[model samples]
Structures are given as structure tokens and as C-alpha cells.
Target: MKPFYEKTIHTKPIFQGRMISLQVDEVELPNGQTSTREVVKHPGAVAVMPFTTDGRMVVVRQFRKPLEKEIYEIPAGKLEKGEDPASCALRELEEETGFAAESLQLVTSFYTSPGFADELLYIFEATGLTQGKVHPDEDEFVEAQLISLEEGLELMAAEQIHDAKTVFALMYWQNKRLKAQLGK
Candidate 1:
């Protein structure tokens, strides 16, 4: 086995926005070759899989500008520069679903798109939920829906719930359901 790393020789900033920034980097490969890499820098984010007392999952349907369509997804938000992911998860849940959780647990964290973007996403599971007033960001428009496991699968099959985060939440939710059914 051998180690392969790209050393950045120069970086040119392309654009900076509230959520993300874009840059192009000149790099030296381990094989002594040079190339340019386009990198997207993000502030990371958090997602929450919220379950109601009745076992239905809480999802929000919103219009995504990039996709030019609406999609259903778990409650999620971008992280502040030094914010705690768990806190962000709870906040997003409440803002998006009008639910506050009494129990919140971290499930997993992963990069959304490692090849181009440096966006780390922390996924969480929230239970013991209490309904509250809906309060999404002024620029954000979403409608919360409670769906059964079968409905979730249907949505996934229909590509209504197309993001990786929501798919993962559904799969994890199913695993938990199975474990409980088997008394695990």
C-alpha cells in the first residue's frame, strides 16, 4: 500500500455566499503531476429524524431552488460557524416541524459530497416530541407531514423524498422498528 495526497499549491476564490463558498485550487499530486480542483466550502449542517408518540415520522416538504422542485425531507438546517450540532438539530426540528423533542440523540455524521464540497452533516434522532407553533425562517416555506413507514417508502420510490439524509433516516427508523418488533 502507498499514500497518495494532493498538496495545494494555490487557491483562487470564486464566490462566497451566506451558506457556501467556492474556490479553485492548484494541487500537486503524489505522482508529481499538477492539476486544479474545484472545491465548495460549506458551514456544515444538522438533520433530525423526529418521531411522534404514535410512531409516525415528521417530514417537511419544501421547494428546493437548485432542484427546481419540492421535496420531502427530515428537519434540518445549516450550522453556524461554531454551533453545537445537537442544538442545531433541535432548533431545526422545532422550526420545520413545530415539534420540540424531549429526547435528542446523535445518530451519525457524514460528508454530503466529499468530491467537491466540504459539507459535514450530523444526523440525529429525536423522540418524546411535543407539538408547538410552526416557525420556519422568514425566507423558508415548508409544510410538515406525518407519514407511516409504508408512506415513507412510497415517497422514496416516487422520489419525493430524494435526499440522502432523509433516506438514511427512514432506513434507520425501519431498523429500529424491526428491532423493537423482535424485542431486541
Candidate 2:
């Protein structure tokens, strides 16, 4: 058996929305105790860090309802049913930033919040970006921003880049920079 496994005894679906589903689960703990878990099920997502040929990083600023604020972040979107992560990344890049990537490389895949949510996020580093048409979703209102890598680092240090995926992508970029400098 897996470590600290919780066997679900019952699951009560609370709400089913377009992007996520909420459920309350009654689970039996490994030590034979029963507990309740409020879980958020998400259909996964993809985030891209696109860098222009001129070395500027493309980001987006949008108003988030949950945060009740406009924040800058890397381009990202949810994965549609039966959609691959790379495809989702490319689509989001073009739709949100008006840029198409000539080279799309997967950086990593991670769970956004493993404590109470099952939302997996796939991150990619996109280079050789070319200007394209902007076409975001009907409900999405995004403003693209192109900044240097140093500016992105400053934004993160100023606590402006708050999202997990965006932060991780930036870290990935930093690591790539280090590796390149080290001639690895």
C-alpha cells in the first residue's frame, strides 16, 4: 500500500462547474480513523514561459476573481478534455500573448495544491516566439507584457508574481540561465 493512504468510504459531490468540481469525501485513515476531506478536482492545466527572439519574456496581466486583483503571470490555460499538455501550452501562448513558439520544451509537471486539490500543472519553456494574433477566450481579458528577465526577477522579489506555476517557470528559467553560464 502507498504511504499514508486514505481509502475513500464515500464521496459527496458538492458542485460541478466548467473548470472544477468540489467534493466532500469520507475517508478511512491508515490508522483506522475516519475523517472528512474537502477536495477540489481540476482537469489539469498548462503554463508557458515564452521568450522572444530579442530575449524579452512574454507575460500577461489579468484580473483574478478569487484574488480580487490584477496580477502579472506567465501565459496559462486549462486543458480541455482529451487535450495534451504541450498543445494546451501552445494554444494558451498564442491566445493570451499573441505569440507562437517555434520551440516548446516541457519543463515540469506538478500539482498546484496537493493538500486539498488535485490540480496538475504542466510548465513549458517556449523560445523563438513569433508575433501572432491575439484571441483569448470569450471570458478572458488579458493584457500581454514583454519584459526582460531581470524585470521578471524583480517582480518576483517584489511579491508581484504570486502564482505557483509562474513562479516555478521563472525558477526554471533561472536554472537554465545558471546552467548555460556554467557551460553545462
Clash counts for the predictions, in order? 0, 0
* Highest lDDT model number: 1
Q: Tell me the tens digit of each residue's lDDT in model 2 across 92-183.
A: 99999899889999878899999999999988989988897999999899999998878988988887788888788677778878998999
**C-alpha TM-scores of all predictions:** 0.98, 0.95
The sequence of per-residue lDDT tens digits that candidate 1 reaches over residues 57-171 is 9999999999999999998999988999999998899988899999999989999999999999999989999999999999999999999999999999999999999999889
Q: Which consecutive 10 residues in model 2 have the weakest lDDT in total?
A: 167-176
> Candidate 1 — worst ten consecutive residues by lDDT sum?
89-98
RMSD to true structure for each model, in Å: 0.8, 1.4
lDDT of each: 0.94, 0.90
